[model samples]
Target: MIQFMLVDDESIIVDSLHRLLEGQEDLPLKVWKAYSADEALDLINIIEKTEGQGIDILMSDVMMPGMNGLDLSALIKSRFPELKTLFLSGYSDYTYLQTALHQEAFDYLLKPVDDETVIEAVRKLCLIIEEERRLKEQEKQNGMRLKQAQRMLNDELLRELLEKPLTPQQLADKEESYVQASLSVDQCFILLNGKVDQWPLTYTEIEKMRQREMIMELMVSMLQPQCSIVPYNGSRHLVWLLQVKRMDHDSETCDLPQLHWYLSEELERVQFTIQERMGLSCSFVISGHEVDWLQIGDVNRKMGELLDRAIGLKSEIMQVEQAGEAMSRYQDIQLQPQEIKKQLLALTGLLEAGEFLAFMNELRSFFETIRKSVFLTYERQSEIFITLAGLYLSYMNSRQMTTEVGMKLDLTYLTNFNKHTDWQSFGDYCVRLAEILFLIVGDDAKEQKQEIAEKVDNYIIQNLSRNLTLQQLADHVHLSKFYLSRLYHSQRGYPIYQKIKEQKLNRAKELLLQDDIKIKDVAAELGFENVPYFTTFFRNSLGMSPKEYKQSYQS
Candidate 1:
């Protein structure tokens, strides 16, 4: 409804206008009368005090004593912006309209106003005000919905990208601000093999997990300017990814083993001090292979097997078997291969016998020996095979791979494992994987490294739309940290990560150019949450706003 307040010095003028306007109902206006400008000011103050409840229109005579109608209109405009005003004066001069415009008055109502002009002005003012209000309301609603959606997407993205465990609500509340950069970011994951057990599963265990995660997060934070860490798999398992780690700086000063020990100690402390706490026993398995996040199901399924077989040992040495050769050929010592094979064969037997404790112990020993052998580079391919086997065993132990997830892990024709320069490493990794599976294993550490690179690259490209990292990729393709890094850099010229970013950016550009789509839609399509950041990235890459760039192309 359009409401009005009428103020004039002459009571007769106010009375006449009130009576005439009272008869009108088509123009949604409710009018009030005051004999003087002072009375109008008081009424306005009361309405303002009432929080804009009843009043919408102000019709006042110009040229009143003390506080003139122009001054009152200006005052009302400064405070009650939504109150539409009409200046009523006997004089028809440009001065009043100019002042009325300055105060943003709706229109000028000439003195001794005719009912027709008054009705028409009121009707027009009401229409304009309502339309403006509607637009503002719509804009507010849109902004709110955008914010909500952004929160949801960011939470999901960060959870996967960071490998951190966060609830949807917590993600919605977290502020995810980005660091502006022209250099593309390559996601990197570090998988550490550690078992944290407390005697009693209490809040203390949770706290211990939190502390360990925090320590790891802090260490990674030092490695990279931005990083995320989170608990995975029953809070005992942890996953970390690099957001923007300084490779050069970390390589120069980073002491990874020391950092690992620090986290281990924190884990131990919680176990010792807290009731029902068991100490944390951990093994370090780091990889920097690039793969997509969606493909993790496959990579993890394979890598989990690696982690499983890497722990626990019945033998002094863990050997990487070559394909098509007797396991005895790969044995370093007379009894080493036989003893390892015996233990491997016994694992399923023990599990079937319901020997959980012994199973865990054997598993732990296998990983310890595997870790020691994996870091050694007597034959680089052997190391790679051992690494792949360990990762596969880890997944097999975890048992997260379902038939649906298995579909993504299949080696296809696109996986060019034969072209790798580290053919020995590729062969070794494959043989080791076969060994982990208890398949017939021979050690032929004579595979090309380029073939390994090709297979890994193919997997990355196939799953580019997901959140993935080098660590996961390395584990999937079964290459050691050192071998994968050397091969990726040697083959790709730049890091394998640069290609991932270029691919994503290319897709983003194509989406931005599409028509009849909201900028928010573009961000969602590219798996970004904040549209503003998407806008910033688009502008930085294309040298103009997305909207402007699209329009330029259209023209």
Candidate 2:
């Protein structure tokens, strides 16, 4: 709603203008009367304070005993730049006109004003006000969207840092963008590698993210008092950089042992809180030594290797020092391909049957058997890796799927067998390759789903005119209604009912464009019992009636 105010030295003029404006019901106006410019300013202030609504238009006489309309307009222009002013004058002198023009009056009117002139001036001001409001609102929404995009970008950058090495200058440049405040590299920091344990494998992706966020928040709150923490994405783990500082000395010369002791105590508290409050256990590994700003990438790599060894040993908390000797104990053992072939065949059957738990169990058993019998020498590990790589390649070839270049290069690295820094690193590489294979091949269930989806699509196209239902489609496909619906949605990216409607509408459009088809016949052909219902559906979808659409096509 637009608010208006009228000011003049004569009380009669103010009352007459107020009455005229108040009678304008179509203008959506709130009118105020003031016998002088001082009174009008006071009224505007009161309205702004009480209702938080300012006047959009002001109509006042040009000549007055005190605070003439020209002076008043200048004050209003300075204070409320958005408020429009229209001046009324009894004199047609050039001086008064010049003053009005100088003050940037919206419009100037002679005495004895007509209702048409008053209403037209106010209406023009209202349009300007509305357009301004719309632009302001649009600007606000765009700002919010930009902020959300920047936040996502920040998270992506943090995740990339964990996976790749960045030089000190490169890291400094990224900090200059949007990550400076969140991550600081001027001080020594320790990388904490954490992974959630005992989380149900059946949880959806969204549920897992929520659980990870909860754990991350809890860990930050518990540890923030001791040091600064920055969380990064770890795919299947929670990674953080704990900035170490000392009150007595600068960050570069802080007491490293004391900082480590403080972190150890805080981590214990954090772990206990997570277990007691959230019913989940977490494993953490701290970097062995304090790292300078640029050495974070190297430290994180070391911590990752230690974390993998800890997982293999089934230990919750492990220090890098504990794995030093085990990492150096690589031995030379002979490869037995025939013996490994039997195990691989059994594992392949489990994978092809979509038995994920059984497959993982069998894979773990094979690894354990090899580890116990031999020392997992570099040569023996390479042979095992080669066998696994060949199996994966064969599987992909049978499915007619192309492997990524990075995966091919990684497999070639395994073939060279020189990149294994230790047995643990080689073992980690092997397990990662197995995961990639599982993801690439997918489960046998999805294969069956794709086949069923293809059949359903053919049926939908052929039976578009039928009154199709989920139960009817399921019967035709010879599957339960619930299972068919779920499988179809998973494979097709939408519900079965929506797909049916979409297909029906598409066919209806085709039939409507034909000159031989009647409107009522088109509706009936698509299983619509009533023509009006079909018309409404078409109008909602395309913003026009079926008849109108056909007419447009002809035109």
Q: Give the top-scoring candidate (TM-score).
A: 2
Total backbone collisions for each predicted model:
71, 0
Which parts of model 2 are misplaced by more than 4 Å?
A: 1-153, 171-179, 245-254, 312-315, 325-342, 345-555
Residue-level lDDT tens digits of model 2 in 1-555: 777888888665576568777887777778888888888899989988987877778888988888988898888778888778889765444467667766767777655344566777787677666656764686596684574455476777776676678786777777665235455555566778886644542233444565676687677767776676777656546787777544444443335566677776677778888787656667787775577766667777777655543322322555555555544443234225576778878877876665544665677677655654422333455566677666556655666654552433356645554444333344545555444443445454566568778888889899876767665777676554444665676677777777777888898889989999999999998876579768876886788999999999999
Alpha-carbon error at 36 in model 1, in Å?
1.1
lDDT of 1 by residue, 1-555 (tens): 566788888765677678767877666667778988778778767765765664677788898877988998777666766777788775544466567766766666543344666777776667666755764686596684564455454444544533434344543444233222111233333333333221121122234444454344334434343323332332223444322334573342334344434443443343333323223334333333343433443444334334333323212111112111322333442224445556566655654444433544565455444434322222332443444445444544565432322333333211343222222223333333332222111112214445666787787667655654554676776544334554566556766556665666777668767777777887776655457656765675668877887778789
Q: Estimate the TM-score for candidate 2.
A: 0.38
> So what's the TM-score on candidate 1?
0.26
**C-alpha root-mean-square deviation, each candidate:** 31.6, 23.5
In candidate 2, what residue range of length 10 has the lowest lDDT sum? Answer: 306-315
